[model samples]
Target: MRAGHLLLSRSSLSHLLLIFTLLSTFTAASFVRSRAPSPQRTAGAASRRDLISDTVENILHPVIHFAPTVLGISINNKGLQLDNGTNPNDPVQVSQALQTQPPPIDLGQLLQDITPNYNTSKTLDSACSAIHTALPNNDYVGRVCTTPECIQSTTHYYNARQAGNRPACVTYPTSSQDVVTIMKLLREYDVTYAIKAVGHSTGYNFTTALGFSSTTGILIDMSKMKAVSYDASTGIARWEPGQSWGELATTMAQYGAQVVGGRLGAVGPGLSFGGGISWYSGQVGFASDTTHAFEIVLADGTFIIATQDNQYSDLWWAAKVGMNSFGIITAVHSRTLPGTTTYGGSVIFPTDKMLDVLGAYANWINGGADKCKKGFVLPAITDFFVESLITRLNIFEFFFDGTDPGECFKDFNIINTLYDDRKVQPYPDFLNKALTNQQFVFSGFNNALYSSVTDLINKDQLLAIYNAWEEYSVQTSGAYLQNTLSFSVITKTGLAASQANGGNAMGVSGGDGYLWVCYAEGSIPAIGALMDTKLFGLTPQAAQAVPKSQRKLPLYANYARLEQKPFLTYGGIELLRQIKKKYDPDNFISSHTTGHDFY
Candidate 1:
């Protein structure tokens, strides 16, 4: 069970060698290997020559001859010796032979020596083999993919940047027990890993394994755990993490109820953990605020239920916007609302109407639209250029909990639009429409996103931010495939609802309304780095354009880029840190897993 004491059997050796060959071939040509030393190996650095010699010595010390019997050769810690008439202890003869003969190679040590910071191929293979052996009869056992084709087949991600990461194995766990088993083995082997729910995350390494030695990583794909159930008596809806919000909505509609969830159908339950925004947020709160409980497996393989009033209540609060820093979530239980038909749809205006659209959005929020607590709107300015043809659009998506929004959306409705598809529709249908229309544009391109919150600004402030964004977009147009700046409001009523339902760790107060701004971009692989570098400055630039009085708000975790520190802006950092320490005392999850870091 220990990594250092691992001894491979003949069958295991063959498996290890096959994995080694595959990984070496896969990475040698396509990926750049990381040479960083592991935490344990960083302290007393050895010279390259000495490290190579020591590796050879370790390999040859545990001599494994192909034949059943040794051929008059004796290997030991000192050196290799030949027992052919010459004295076996003769130093000169042994030294000469050591210089001439090729030393035996220990596949395990060789792998370790090369991959100091990652689990060796032997260790990874052993872990995978153990998983297959432990869960032989489980349906998901067949889904433990190791070959390139199988890994590729199961490795689809919404962001192309994440798709490029190749884990040594991809595991599909159907239940908490399966996840517990995998977590135990991964910890035992000290392997780095990433978890995938729907893979809708934009940040690199957020849902996929990355780095030069990422071939040794493991990806725990939770897609097979899609199971949903409803309790009509209590109006509670329970589901596994594998399903999407769209699927959950459709299924819950059959029960005449719906859970607060993401607006996009393809986005999974992971959104709730990042403080999900939804069409219903204006009436209820964040999607996370509706969570009744969570069934999660900790880094030490302990499976427990986290609820607002349970022994793990702190974990419940942290999990709301924790962003995968605590553990792997298996299941979620949420409060359900009546599944009533809602009025919502998208309206697209021409580029020339940008000011009008901005003014409408500003007026709606600043003019007490949040007071209605039944309407939600997302306004975005998008610029798309293809084949040297540029197109600019002002798109607004409006929603209401009931059939009529009344004067809530009057300003937006009066704008002259290029395309208007507003209508009364079912909640699930509206989500499906948005998904079909919006998710297809950046299908194959690498993407990056940044998020910030500000006080509901006036028309002039919105215009200034828009102008800055437009200038940045035009300056970097040739570097990207598409760019968009979108805004969503977090109403005071919504924040009150969140506080009523066990306040989360997002650090927002109900004193006033605020706006969530998201800047997203997509580019080809060759320009992904350039796009990210430029995109990093966009949020700060826009913040500077607005007055300081209106810009000191928390960043939304779900929409934030990798480098942005949403946790730093949170008001409950000390409590969050204590909860993290109590739950993950050794910091194993944060150290071994790739996710948004809290510290």
Candidate 2:
């Protein structure tokens, strides 16, 4: 996110600038370690030591050198020219060179050579020790743990697949200043790190560090930062990154208010960064759209507040759906609505009624369902594996902003159901119940979600898509413990609400209705790869069933697979890239952390 000036001392600024210059100027090929003896230097040629010294001097001073050309472009009276005599100023040639070029100089080697007593081969234990030394005598030290018990508690992910990662240490920061201190130390020591809020993300490396060679890795646990408050005068709600939807909803209910948040209770505030969809989305838009401001810690360890009409407004726009590419979000302030009584609960039907359920859902949405802005529905064909056999069930979740849904869900009401639990209840109570039920059924399984988006489909298209997913699931039943195919309608009212409130990065419009189709699976580690590969293949086949015009819709980032490039479909790639470059010119976040790839 955008910020004011970097918060670094003069000496640190100079050191960082020197490092940045060296990294930008040289390629890895220039510093490759060789076992062969050095060649004899010709008369008047400089030695390797002399070359390095001269390079450092030239970087510090703003003097241009012609001897050592970069990217085959040399500064002269004739201007920039490539080795092949092509114009280096041409965007096409420059882009081609960037694509074909090798990686930049190694930071570890560069730091070791440039900084006094800086070790390039630091271990996780040593790094944690260093952090402890830096923050000694502070309460934060107690939160920084390297013990197995602490790590296990900090790395408790909703998806079992993510729980296998063992970082060098886990540090829980309870305030923005605490995060700033930890972030500064991590950057100073050149440690790779990942930020974890509630650990609901299913993508590999999305909330954990994958691998660390010579350097160490750390997990910044935000769970201890759980805090929530609401303002009665402004109708605004403020929550820390660690607060879950259920917690936030329950807290807001005390104030007779609510903010658009995750549908599930366990999801953290991080959901807003991925364009969160909530029961209130039909009326207020995505959770990201409801956000009024973000308290962020930039890559350089500087804190800034981003809002719709502020100096950091660009960051405000991008952070809405930019994921974790920008910086760490410490707190979110959002617009709130009155906490009205809600009508919502799950309805379960036997597998035999799948077609009837699908038909009714399609008919409801097609027949002016968008006009009922206060209503939302999600229908899923869920399967449970028990005793070597699978049992399939049709589960439909419905919600209305008020006490009743009126005629909004009449089509689905007529279908015979094996079980029905629809009722009028307080919003917070419904969310807590849903989360309790989900955890009882799906906890402890290695889970992931694969998703795609397309125009709202007809009965035949829905049936075709369901059959394709069901065939694949049955064929690979041995690979997974549970499989579910679910759909969320993105109505015209939702799109309009998003625009009415300052728009987000997801480039959807109210031209036509759409559905975010997701395939969620729970499996063992032994077959996770096979399940992912086969499930990924369903995207193209599902897209083919929809009209060609609506085949390239933006995939929902919250439910997307690691392989899916949701950002590319946002229709604002160039703007996003520019914002990234503006805020993170050194590429510090992308280099030192792992998550969804935005560049």
Candidate 3:
């Protein structure tokens, strides 16, 4: 683009808005097939034809920020294409003599000529065919699997989008080099592919294969890549993306070190990249903050070691905190700290105690700096299960970093409880529990939840939100399966700890503690879509109940709806653009994957 580029006409603006609205609803029609490019870009530079193609590209593929559409010119099987000129893959220029007259080389066989090993055409077949075809030839066929044994290995991600859907074929990579080979194959064939770690992610495309029908993309499962090692002298732990926090904790217990990570036994690398929130956050910080570097494979089948100081440092920092983008991380060398026994446990209370419990939680978070700082601490996590529209159970899943329950649990001790399970446990033993409320929301239930800043919320406001959840759950319980509401506290201790050891990218202001209000709905497939609409809607309504002066809601991307734009709240779109430009200059991969928008 020059001093001035062609501004999108009012007519084009109208078209974009229409497309956005249509895409807002989950309909196949909204995802139009990308059209093929023209036979040749015979026009000269900055010609009227070039500008038209550039303008159309901006409208069709909108990013957080669209740089001047370079030229979408390429020489693929179709010929000298020039539809999306700014496409980084496009050739900069062709010899002047060649552009004037087309060569006699057969266009039909041209694609294979460039990449002879790949499929000559985008063959219309299940992704299984591609996987089967590549198996015997690639060196990784021993790890390549179409057998039930291999597929059965990843049955744990209970969400339907993850567990129910299966990939056409699963390729297990044992190392970063294996991933590079897989990436090259996928790119050569132009096949849609997805990368899976510990199957806990929620999206259909993220954990399974992609397809126009179903089961199309070849899945790269990272389970076998669970190679873990550590350099005690350097305090750096090399963890394959597939390793779980629980597994790592047990391993580190032997070494007297711990890697900050998700509290659950199954939470894996994907969440690690999405700002891993852990119980230890109050004592240390976010899991991502301890990430020393990343071994990543870029979209173009290139490998780079990204560190805070590496040439690809921008990509490293971006992947650490942001949603999936730019590349697939193979392994993360994370920093570790001394491991020790921690104390805390669960207490049970009736639903009626919510008001009192929330008030106490608010007070606990509002308490002074020393109690909430990066030292000995106790953080509270609650799971309020809606046993019925009329009855609720409050379970306090609180913890302290030391071997004894200190005064931090004082606010909660006063509340009468039906049972007490608090006790001191080794770090590895405590990390085994994954605190999801499974008693109410089962494996089969389709669920979604939202989190809002709790500092502005009080006990009365929380009770109102609970009331809304109860009402919705009651109305839908008859038609659907069930629904529930829960609360988790991220005290100032955790907030301040997130800023420790180089800080993390959770996108929160440092040094202040707040409550995270969480609501979950579980239902049958028929009403799952409806539940999603309602669940996403009620989040803001819950926030609005807070006084206008105090209302500042930043939805956690980890818990947000698919359509929700959470990246913007993390920081700014401007920074997102600068990094994307440096990393994925060629707009090849981002569009095919799931995550929030680039922002």
Q: Given candidate 1, what's the lDDT at residue 503?
A: 82
The lDDT-based order of candidates, best leading, equals 1, 2, 3
Question: Which ranges in model 2 have alpha carbons more than 4 Å from their true place?
Answer: 1-127, 134-155, 205-216, 435-441
Q: Which ranking of candidates, highest TM-score first?
A: 1, 2, 3
Candidate 1: regions farther than 4 A off: 1-120, 137-154, 205-216, 435-441
lDDT for model 3 comes to 0.52
| Clash pairs (backbone) in predicted model 1 | none
**Alpha carbon lDDT of residue 343, candidate 1?**
88
Better of 1 and 3 by lDDT: 1
Candidate that beats the other on TM-score, 1 or 3, i.e. the better one: 1
lDDT of each: 0.66, 0.65, 0.52
lDDT tens digits, residue span 450-521, model 2: 788888889899887887777665555434555788888888788888888877777777677688888888
- Window of ten residues with lowest summed lDDT in model 3: 107-116
Tens-digit lDDT track of model 3 for 120-205: 12331333355555444332222123345453433334343344333335666777777777676666666655666765554433
* Candidate whose TM-score is highest: 1
Measured against the true structure, the TM-scores of the candidates, in listed sequence, are 0.77, 0.76, 0.70
lDDT of 1 by residue, 313-376 (tens): 9899999988788899998999988865888887777666667877887877784567668888
lDDT of 3 at 479: 28
